[model samples]
Target chain A: MHLTFYTIWPCALFNINRMQSISSSSYAVHFNQRAYDALNGHLSEKSYSKIFIVVDENTHEHCLAPFMGRIQGTYDFEIIELESGEENKNIDTCTQVWNVLSELDGDRKSLMINLGGGVITDLGGFVASTFKRGIDFINVPTTLLSMVDASVGGKTGVDLGPLKNQIGVINQPEMVLIVTDFLKTLEERQLQSGFAEMLKHGLIQNAGYWEELKEVSHFKLMDDLIYESVQIKNKVVLEDPTEQDLRKILNYGHTLGHAIESYFLENVEKKALLHGEAIAVGMVLEGYLSKDLVGLPEAQLADIKNTFLGRYPKVDFTEDDIKAILALLKFDKKNSHGNINFVLLKSIGDPVIDIQVPDELYKKAFAYYAEN
Target chain B: MHLTFYTIWPCALFNINRMQSISSSSYAVHFNQRAYDALNGHLSEKSYSKIFIVVDENTHEHCLAPFMGRIQGTYDFEIIELESGEENKNIDTCTQVWNVLSELDGDRKSLMINLGGGVITDLGGFVASTFKRGIDFINVPTTLLSMVDASVGGKTGVDLGPLKNQIGVINQPEMVLIVTDFLKTLEERQLQSGFAEMLKHGLIQNAGYWEELKEVSHFKLMDDLIYESVQIKNKVVLEDPTEQDLRKILNYGHTLGHAIESYFLENVEKKALLHGEAIAVGMVLEGYLSKDLVGLPEAQLADIKNTFLGRYPKVDFTEDDIKAILALLKFDKKNSHGNINFVLLKSIGDPVIDIQVPDELYKKAFAYYAEN
Candidate 1:
């Protein structure tokens, strides 16, 4: 594999306060009280045919009333709830929601607000984009995974069979509302799933962010971290809207990350790891490869290993599991012309893309992850 | 509704040769020999992981062998075929194709060639667009309806139940290959269905073209007409990619035309008319409303009525059928905030969009359609 250097996106594109909203190409990501205000103003400004809020059972019970209470206008909104799980995030669910929207008289001018986690935002964003050849939608992300990741990058899709996010589109929402209160609704496991992505934001684009993120004792204490993670993500997305080059860096750990997540999800006996948990394992395996290929320092490599292992315990990978996981790597979206490409970090805050790692090194990388 | 004048897309954007290709936002429409040459050049140029050619049953039997014989490359291509007709143009069919793509190792770098009528191009385009957040695709339209209308415009979508094209996105294919020879495979009724769009194009934009179109006794002899019709369609689509304002004029007869089409499609007892056959009736119905609503002259209205009636025999619509057709208009993608909008003509070749005709006039319009 040959080394190709890429320009890292600037951390501070401009000086702004901690709570300020970040804007991408077509939409803005508003935070907290400002998010609700922006939504209300937008609602009042445009004459929508209808307003539909998409939620999972958890969000419908928890996030919906609070989200609706914040609305300042006298608008009627229909709540379409789906069953919450990664399994439910597929084309079949999208069909059900689409049928509901059509049955409820949802038209071209209808506004859809996605009020759950990544599944809600990704699935709901896709539903709005395709229904009637596109409709306006807002993402009121209610989980850390969605806010830090799916909130900025217009990556709306669902899993096709065992593959992760195999069907979807990159169409932006009208706006993204990041409410930290919704983050509190998540359990430690789900919250940590999002936290893993924030830590990735630091490792790929900002060393200071990685340093600050690694120091956080509690996952709940993340208002500032969410802002910083989104800034890093938004900066990367703005530079590459359609994910040509610079955007692949955002998929740094996601190369093996998605494959690992898919393997765990598909295996009948294995307990399904949360999105971040699977990615957490991916970072370690890829980090081991980065040390040899990208000259990642020994001390920093150790730091990376310890930082994640502290929260994410190592899972038992049998020989069959490892073989299956390796087989799934070829199905990754990043792959082209039958070669597995890696987005490796030259160092913290420095990323190199489209680097091929040979098939021979797979076992060694897994050995490094399994080592004391 | 007040009269608003829109700048009609010019016939002579630039004086290119008769058989020359026409360019849209990102892709071009290549004719006959030029179409085959472009496809061969495209196939040899890109290193695609897999080449998927989407076809319907009819195209698989007739269009595929001839289409494949033109290709100069030795590249392996996979054929994914679906059931023909508008009934198959829905999310369920899209799910089947998407599954087929995943099952076979179709990836981001794969190239899709749509080789069928409008349903194939529309559904295949959506499948390619959403498969792994979109892959590159080309269109080789195999019907007169598809060649003249769906060739230039990047309107890729599937029908939602009874509503026509109520689901999908405005995504462009890599290139479109328009081969007039394939029109021979279409039945007389199907050819007339496409001819309806050609008539509408001339009515909405060019009276000189309309006069020429009326002179052609056979739909079989339409090479220059197809080129000119695509030129008109391409000019309008280029000006407005997302159908915001100027593009609305293209929907001249489609407002009531789609409603009539859907009404006939949903009722199993009623014979399902080809798209253009229903639109021919719509032009008569809407032309009557245009006389009173948009100052359409008596002579021009008679010209339109006689031109369409000469081709399409009148169908007896029970009073109930007329009521059901009118009720179906509310579900149209063009409607906004519960207002039924129409694209009415001030005269031949000049149309005004977003005009509302009162309920009192719909019955009168139907009566005018029933006139001797």
Candidate 2:
């Protein structure tokens, strides 16, 4: 293995916290050093039928060459490149992968390495999960959002029409490899989009981390900060890998975030919000909602709003548009028996799972955001 | 629970030898006694979010009333009836069911009961398996072939274009409740179709049973025989739930059976081969192939051929027709690579799985049958 020196330690040493255990299978998230060591060991395992790499057009151009270069001759493998976009993540693409793998005589013993952002990790993991009932796969996350959020959870799937993640299976990969090097090729807007999730991660779990995050805003700092943000998410996912309870904490910004994403996707002429962009907006509005549910200090709420507004200048929402977004919230996949349940924060750092906000309270919450 | 009397209990209670032990999530074929006793269980204990019964317009007219009366107060549910016949078991119908199910708020926890013949069982099970990742379902098979074949294996899916079971998942149902009483309303041709699989069960696993089967032709006697056939399948499935090895024995006649079934379905003027009817022809032809593979006495092979031809008359096959049928053999979903594998019999009661048959052999096998 021709390993490049990313960190000072020629042979990097690291430890991982085993916080989450899944019922169906087990998986590990290699923080730094362990992740690098795992690469050699995985390639040496002689029992696999074949190794497969799933990438997108963008990742194939930027990430695949460097990623494969590290372990070039260690294993025999093949590659499948999918169209690069969230719009292509559906059953049609899944069928295409299934057909290709079947034609290649892929069997259950094969391993899949998903080397891209959230789209590749999600769609590739999903394809491996359903192929021949299930197969082993690894997530090599290249984006900050996928590293901190998507890669840790076992949720793998694609969207259906206007619905997000409407079709999917909750199957964890065998391991996840988070290498910061891929971030170098990420576009500036993509880098900014991913940082919003990191900010939300700090806000939901660690008050100390939230305080530490008051540092100056630049996408460059993500490298030094990704480890801590991943830990916060890793802790919650470990507690509830299936999103039955504690995992709901991760949905702090996603409730409204998804609605805004869906709304803008339909209204294509309007500028589309990256998943993280919508969540940034979600955190601001939900902060006001949190103030009503539990007494978050006025200073903290204002700080949350001003911090995000400073990075992402406010996108105006008319009353009608706000109503349409609110209507979409009812269709949220998490809702039970057609009732909208919001994940509200008790404080900037702590979140309470499965709190049902009254319809009247939702109306009030939206009006507060509109007036503010 | 309604207690029912059985003529044979300890005498007919044959344990499936291949299954080491039953798993909690195992697909159970509740033959004679167990199927009748399950009516008393509450719907809440069934682990389904909602219960859906899939019936055909014909079954709605003929068999729905009697079956609904049995499990009426046990659960509050709705019936989804589709158009009758093998012709409608395509992707178009599956899409319609998906649309209806999406609007009904059907999620993973919902249960689908296939309450008619093979078409309902196959298509309904397909719909349930693909709906919202997958849902729990049951098979209350009213037809003979479905009760013995479709209900036993978890291969649920719909046909794609001209291909059968092209889009599907191999997910087991919670239970299979085979009520033979509903067979009273089945047309004679449908009953004959179901009988084909029963003969296959006898031919592949029990020479003694196969000998005894030659004497029985009545519906009442067929019910007892169907239970035995289900036991054979249940035992094989329990051993290899995913069709890796021993389960291939179940495909005794299906290779040629499917080709003939598809051929009949495509031709309008020609009478369609009921699943069993096609298999009857397949059994006769494969019986000849078995003669070549194993040293079967000429008398035994002749007896098997005469019995099938006597029961279900042969359909003429021209050289060109045989070539087309042979080409369709390549599309079997069980095939991974380009190789065409067959489950050939070593003896009347023993099937050898994964026998690689050359393309030349298919031509010879067809030529032998075409002349016969």
For residues A172-192, could you state the per-residue lDDT of candidate 1 as single tens digits? 999999888887777988888
Write down the TM-score of every candidate.
0.93, 0.83
B92-115, model 1: which lDDT tens digit per residue? 888888877776778788999999
A246 Cα displacement, candidate 2 (Å): 3.2
Q: In lDDT terms, which candidate is top?
A: 1
lDDT of 2 by residue, B73-146 (tens): 34436678888888898656866776666566565556777888878887887677656556667878888888
Q: For each candidate, what's the DockQ?
A: 0.63, 0.20
lDDT by residue (tens digit), candidate 2, A1-372? 011222211332334433332122376777444565676677666456667889888888898766665662344477888887777877778777877766565666678889998988998887787665566799999887788778787888777666677666677788888877678888877887888888888788887787777674666646457877777787787778766688888888788889998898778677778888888888877887788777767888888887887777577787778889888776667765555567777788878777777666756655655555
Model 2 chain A: ten consecutive residues of lowest lDDT? A1-10
Q: Which runs of model 1 end up more than 4 angstroms from their true locations?
A: A1-18, B1-18
